[model samples]
Target: MEGQVVMGLQKLRVMIGSTTAIGLRALARLPHGTRLIGLAASYPVIERWLRALLCVYQPFPDIETATKYIRRFIPAGHEHSDVVSQLKQFADVTRESDYPVLFYLSGYAPGLSRVFDLGGGIGNLFYPYDRELRLPATLRWMVHDLPDKEEIVLQFAQSRHENRIGFSRRMEDASGVDLFIVSGALHYFEDELAVILARLAELPRLVVVNRTPFSRADPIVTTQVGDGYVHACKLHSLAATIAGMEAVGYRLVARWPVHERASRVPLRPDLNDTYWGLFFVLEADRRRRDASL
Candidate 1:
């Protein structure tokens, strides 16, 4: 009897999913159907169907695929070649040039700081900053990633004998961190982004999100294929993302486009392909600290 009930539930889920998908595709053909469907349909239902559609068209054998592709595709010992290239370009800019990120950090975290780099991928962001800038003496950079990735970072840090850098496989180790840097990583944790944000008890004073894809229309989940591996990525809603941050006592201070990469939704070609970077600060805490300073 229990088995029968489980099978019935599964069947119902599939039926609802298929009907929702068909309705959405049908609505896409009409003149103003996209807007109408967005208003009428639930976001979760639509997102589920979008994932299903992507799987049918662009199947990924594994969702949690490793980043060993970086080694295979990118040159060895240059895992962060992309970031390094960007930094090299920035180096040509005059000292008077207004780089918002550098300016913001100078004003907000002028002194010694501790940074928790979530999904940092072998400390790519930190490597550039450490090599390029004269940071405070007491700076500590902690990178949180998968265990295998952590080992990779550890090896990299050891090779350089970097005392200021550390690695962790757990998010809880980020406690008391001053800055939380999340670059090109939120999409991979689409389902858990909200939960992870909400659970951060020791909220950082600053949060930096770079190369995150967002859509004004609706949230989309699609498979990204490259280097013979497939991984799921989500293009989330801009408004929804802002709201989630606001719920956690953070406010957007600045935002800019990441023009290096352009990506379109596989199912919905109408949406823009541009990605963006966002800087957020804990509003009340920042204001109080500023006043004190």
Candidate 2:
């Protein structure tokens, strides 16, 4: 699987407003034969430093931490925090389940797209489960993102051989599951909200959504603003994303805050952006009785 070759430098520079786009362009432009060699030669120090840096920076991969990181830099509430409130409101709707299947989504990023992260900050949202090493009921763990990011996930999952995470297609060997989650991922889709819902409907039960945006597409992440300026990228407000999910089928199960303080990966500069917010999930048992069974 490969990422899409979309977004030219000028457009991307405006989108992410980062030099990373330029480097990715260079990396992409490199002939396949020499690309690896060129990357190794160019980034030997970066690779080594990252490897060593991983040793020092350790924190629970939980949702609260993610929200903390997001809120650290990007404005969460005021007007921004409305997204979190909507998620909380939705979560309030579901006072039932003790442990529901959790789905986490995030917007697309270059290197970060390759993992099954349920919410942000080294996948902090799912930390309790993974930390406790507990398995989800019926295990409908979801890792949602853009198609390109999902493509990256496919590649990485392939290399990992096998793990219970089951996001890997070969391992999952299935189209849908019990729960579907999208943390930061929901905002990217301004159109075709129905497709995401349809995807959710195919699943068996439960859904969790966190860190998504409402309308006007907040672009939750930051982009280089005018000159040195940085504009917060909009993520879908929780209400809008939930409404869209409801439009396609599926209902909100739970939403609540996992409040956490900001922490840094140190090596993962991307995680440094502050965020702290709610835990949200939506669920519906597969409607097509005995289908995909």
Candidate 3:
């Protein structure tokens, strides 16, 4: 009788939790319901318990602040060998989100020589893209990532006899590149896109930021607890990102939804957002116009 009662209570709790989650999500969709939910979520004790229960953690004002908190649990979550090894499995694979990037690259392939891949992992895109696109013989694809990833990428490149792909530790090396790409890693940095670009001496004509999370609301830093890893991710406003690019003399040429990735920062339905794929091109005329203004 006691065992049966315990099992019955467990099932009841599961059912109640599922029903509540579904109800909350449905409520978030209704008029002003999201605002009401947000107000309730803002209570300090409730927020702490909700975050703990959901495993999604707190809402931070910036990436630096979030990072400090996350480091207490895990030291350099992404730099682990197991994580890099697991990511290597996708080196030759292409997803639906990759098609948009390939489409843009097809147009610029003939003259594309230098590509600075910010936070690119061990030439994941390079291997797959080379098979599909007519890549230039003089291509120098630089993967900028953690120091440990360099040797791994170098060995991987050598294994395939790919002399075109290399590794760089310096962001300054991104200057004068033919193409600048930041796929799925832009949110890891504290700086805004425009702020980073401003530091570059000569901005690349083409920029592609893919599979990055962006919010319609103001930016907030959140903790992403993955298998054996934890990362501090900042979801910036989509409009702010576009405006920042325009401010840096780049125009939005294309934008697409990365439906595979989404962020639901627990309790904060207002902060939930899907990932985005964006393409930008530098315009000298726009630069001149902005300067004149």
> Which candidate ranks first by TM-score, i.e. highest?
3
lDDT of each: 0.61, 0.35, 0.79
Model 2 misplaced regions, further than 4 Å: 1-128, 136-162, 166-174, 190-194, 199-201, 215-234, 257-286, 289-293
- Positional deviation of 194 in candidate 1, in angstroms? 4.9
Candidate 3 lDDT over residue span 33-142, tens digit each: 78987887779887666554433255677887777865654555778777788668768788789899999778888889899999898878787788888688899999
Return the top candidate by lDDT: 3
Poorest 10 consecutive residues by lDDT, candidate 2: 105-114
What lDDT is reached at residue 31 by model 3?
99
For model 2, residues 122-209, the per-residue Cα lDDT tens digits are 2223434443334433343344432333443344435543233333333132234433344554433433333444543243333454
Candidate 2 yields a Cα-based lDDT of 0.35
- After the best TM-score superposition of candidate 3, give how far the Cα of residue 261 lies from its true spot, in angstroms: 1.4
TM-score of each: 0.65, 0.36, 0.84
TM-score of 2: 0.36
Model 3: CA > 4 A from native: 1-33, 48-56, 285-293
Order the candidates by TM-score, highest first: 3, 1, 2
Worst 10 residues of 3 by lDDT: 284-293
Candidate 1 local distance difference test against the native: 0.61
Ranking by lDDT: 3, 1, 2
